[model samples]
Target: MSLMDYTDQWLSVVQPQISQGSSWLADLRQGAVEQFATQGLPHARLENWKYTDVKALAKREFVLPKNAATQADALVAETSLALDGIRLVFVNGLFSAAHSQLDALPKGANVLPLADNANVAKTLLGQVAAANFSGFTALNLAAWQDGVVIDLAANTVVEMPIYLQFVSTEHTDACLIQPRILIKAGVYAQATVVEHFAGAEEAANFTNVVTEVDLADGAQITHYKLQQESVHQYHIASLHVQQQRDSRFTSHNICLGGKLARQDIQVELNAEGAEVNLNGLYLGNGRQHLDNHTLVNHNAPHTNSNEDYKGILNDRSRGVFNGRVVVHKNAQKIEAHQSNGNLLLSDKAEIDTKPELEIYADDVKCSHGSTTGQLDENALFALRSRGLDEAMARGLLTLAFANEVIDRIEIPAVHDRIELAVAGRLPEKFNLKGLV
Candidate 1:
């Protein structure tokens, strides 16, 4: 059957569940699903999705997760960062108060489940504009049941980071889960957030997530995402961010698992002096496929944006990176730079990277470039001459190539976690601990 047919079937089955909400929300959901019906899953025919096709996602019959509760404590412990902070846990896309720490938040900080605060959440939901998003985004908007909301008061500085954990359990039948997150930073406020997606080792599931962030004037936020789903799972996520005058936003994305995974990040600088920085790392082995796409809009004068993404592909794994930066008219004095670099460890591994810059303002300084190649033979030879074996030398070089992006992570625990995960993906013959 065609993807549209599959989508229609699923929508029909979930219509009842989607209808069990406030009238306003129900109307919003209906509108979003209607939009999805008009535009099915993005295909290779679409320019933005030309490399990573979503048609394969329709082959599997995925049903909404059953209400049956799964033991998530063990899973959370295994994936824990061990950082001291407020932790919000979601099991199979439903909020788990038993595992979450929501009490005694910093003064002026408000945290709650979106379902519990629908009246307030409604005002913030779908506020950020994502004109080029695909049908998955609409599906997520229509189907998401519960998620987290964070709001910070003006001038508040949250020293401790916030951790949002999502765990998917292994089910007998393939299932689907959609989680949404909304974060609003008040003027002059500063905060950090970490989003973690994990699942059982061999679960066949599909996870669709959407996150919206709004940063007011002088606000700053550091966001991080770590995707470590099962090799049999499919994961797709979208992040939309809007920045006001003199605001700053940073994102660090680390993708370590999933048979097929894709993430889209879009940011808009809506006022002068707004700044954004995006860094990402994805490692794929076996038959895995990972794709990262990003777009930044420089809509105001004196705004700046920097983006760098790196990929490591081994075995027959495939990777894709597409980044675009647009400088709008009258948005002069903008400085934007984008770079995507890839390292192929095996001859069969493949990578496709494209960096695009559309400049309408002549005074803006915008540049983008992409590079994909195997390990440097000269560096490998030098390492071998230093008494290191071929495998060890290659492992060290590969780790170094990936570290250029990891080292940019400011959080020590996050940096360590990413380092460990990358080391585990290397060949067993190479001892990467010492090199890191």
Candidate 2:
């Protein structure tokens, strides 16, 4: 069936649910639906989505999950990250109060579920709008059910990180879920947020997530996203951020599992002295496909941005990295650097990496580099010549290559978790307990 036909059928089933919001939100949903209808699912023809073809997503007949509350308990137990923090759990894209813990937040910190606070939700929803909304983003805005809104008061610092956990529990049939998140950090405030996605190993699910972050002057935020869904699942997520004067934003993205996964990150430095740092790691095994696309816009003078992304591909898996940095005509004195590195564990594995720099200002310092190659034979042989076996030596070298990005993570718990996750995907004979 054509995408238009499938969208028409799906909208018919979800129109009623979309009509429950206030007039402004209703209008927003309507406009988003129209936009999606006009553009349809993104394909290779689109420059941004050239590497990841989402047309395959339209082939499946996915339905809304039924009574996600019933599976919330087991799913939560199975997908715990064991990180200490305030937890906000979502079951199939809907906020679950029973599974969340928000009582211990600081006095100035506010964590509210959008479903319960529609009036306040409308004010913050889609505030940091996407510069060029993709078809999937439009569809998410139209069909989103529930999400979390995090607000920090001026000058207030949140000591503990905030964890947003999204769990899908539809294993019997194909399911579609849209999860939305909005974060506003007040001036001089500092906080950390972790967005995690996980689901049953055998479930055939499609998860589309959109996250918007707004940082006030002098505010600082450290954000981490970990995607570990079922190998049979399809995942597409977009993160858009706006930074004000002297504000700082840092992101660490880890993509580990999914049949086809794509992540898009866009940051706009709208005021002078704003800074951004982005680090990402992705691991692909079997025939899985993983793509990471990032854009940093230097709109103001004296802004700084850094990006580094690494990928490890095994078997026939494919990986892609596209990093674009743009410095406006008037945005002089800007410093931008981007790098993408890939390791191919199998001869059949493939990688496509592009690092772009568009600097209109004369006083800007910008550079980008990308490298794709197999494991270094000399290094492997050196390790094997010592006490290590071939498989152990290869695994150690791969982990060392990935540790460059992992070691930059500020949170110890998160860093340890990622190390274990990466170790699990390595060769069986490799022991990563003491290495990482």
Candidate 3:
């Protein structure tokens, strides 16, 4: 199928099935659909999508397949972390309340499905994550049926982190699943959120998602994303964040699986004293392709941002990293730093890394760098001389290289999970399972 064919099918079959909400929402959805159909998918011709192409995604036939919610419940039960927090589950883009745990919530907070909370949804929907960010984002804005809406009251503190589980089943083949996530933090509020995306090994699901976050003055939010989807799946997601005065926002993105995966993140510091940090790790092998793109805008004085992304590619896999930091005019006293490091384990493995810095202010400090190469042979040999075999030594060296980002995770369970996944990506002979 071609791009037009898939878009026609979505508009004719899928759009009519989802219940039309209020008049304003209906208008927004209508406009977004028109925008997506006209513009189509992002291609290599576009500078932002030059390194990563989505022609295949545009050619695939998109159908809304019926999924068995029971499988998703079982998947969440087996995969979710054992944390003391509220869990929101989604099965093939539909909300699954049976498996969700929302017994307790802070007073005056709105934590529910986005469609269910019309009052809060109307006030902020499409306000932060504008539709023109990308084609997939516009499509998600049009077809997002259900999503999580988190609205915190002033000075509120969520003791436990929130868990969001999105699972795809074998029945999700050739499906078009679009989910939206909207988070609003009140003044001085604090919260942590973890988002996990995965699918059945047999399913070749297509997931297009958008997450919008708005932080009020002095609010803090830490977001952790773990993407371990099926190797046959195609995943595209974008995160848009807006920070106010003295607000803080941090992100940890771990990408481990997907046939063609791309992630786009943009953060805007709109007020003085705002701060942001972005950390990411991606591992690929067996012909997988992973792409990560980030942008930080220092729109106010005294703002700060730090970004670090690492990639490990083996076999014939490929990786791409493009990070840019912009210090706007009059944004004096701003400081921004960005770095991308990659390790290629095979001769055929390829990595394209570009770090860019745009500074219009004279009194600002900004720096960006990118480095890509093979594992340190000297370090490997040093480990070998300490009585460790070649395979074990190689595994140790690679793990240590990736651990620079993993060690920054404060949550013990998340750190251990990432460590285990990193070790498992190594060759079979390099057995460093429990050592991590």
Q: Per-residue error at 99 for model 2, in Å? A: 1.4
Candidate 2 residues lying further than 4 Å off, grouped into runs, are 1-5, 376-378, 429-436
Q: Which regions in candidate 3 have their CA more than 4 angstroms from the true location?
A: 1-6, 17-19, 65-67
lDDT string, candidate 2, 1-436, tens digits: 4556566766765576677688888888888888877777776777987878766777677777555866569878788778776998888887887888887798888888776666766767777865237888887788777778888999989988898888877566777788778899999999999999987777678898899999999999999999988888899999999999999999999999889999999999999999999999999999899999999999999999999999999889999999999999999999999999999988998899999999899998888899986688999989988989888888898998888998998888888888888888865666766665
| Poorest 10 consecutive residues by lDDT, candidate 2 | 1-10
**1-436 per-residue lDDT for model 1 (tens digits):** 5667777876875576578579998888888888888887887878988878777786677877765334777877787786676888888788888878876478978878777787778778888834237888888888787888889999988888888888888888887788889999999999999999887897778998899999999999999999988888899999999999999999999998888999999999999999999999999999999999999999999999999999999899999999989999999999999999998878999998889899999898877888886788999999999999998998988898889999998889989988888988876777776666
By the TM-score metric, which is better: model 1 or model 2? Answer: 1
- Measured by C-alpha RMSD in angstroms, how accurate is candidate 1? 1.7
For lDDT, candidate 1 versus 2, the one ahead is 1
TM-score for candidate 1: 0.96
Question: How many residue pairs clash (N, CA or C atoms closer than 3 angstroms) in each of the candidate models, in the order given?
Answer: 0, 0, 0
- The local distance difference test score of model 2 is 0.85
Error of 1 at 126 (Å): 0.8
| TM-score, cand. 2 vs. native | 0.95
Q: Give residue 226's error in model 3 in angstroms.
A: 0.8
Largest lDDT belongs to which candidate? Answer: 1
